[model samples]
Target: MRTLKQALLALLVLSSAVADLPTEMPIPEAFIGSPVGTASL
Candidate 1:
């Protein structure tokens, strides 16, 4: 459970970092199954 939480946090941080890097940034396989929402809250 702890590892999963850490992985989620890591993925979130990684995604934000990637999003800021550029539009052409590549996502690693570790982020493949992560959930994404179409609606912005």
Candidate 2:
């Protein structure tokens, strides 16, 4: 159980690190050409 908790914590940390990186990393240029839909909820 302790090891599982530690693994979950490690995963959470890694996900946060990835999300903190620049949002401008290369992506399909066409993705930007089409407007993103808005959320209604």
TM-scores of the candidates in the order shown: 0.54, 0.50
lDDT of each: 0.53, 0.46
Q: Write the per-residue lDDT of candidate 2 for residues 1-41, one digit (tens) a residue.
A: 99688667655654565466567753333234323211111
For model 1, the local distance difference test gives 0.53
Off by over 4 Å in 2: 23-41
Candidate 1 segments whose C-alpha is farther than 4 A from its true place: 24-41
Q: Pick by lDDT: which candidate is best? A: 1
Clashing pairs in 1: none
Q: What's the residue-level lDDT of 27 in candidate 1?
A: 56
How high is the lDDT of residue 20 in model 2? Answer: 61
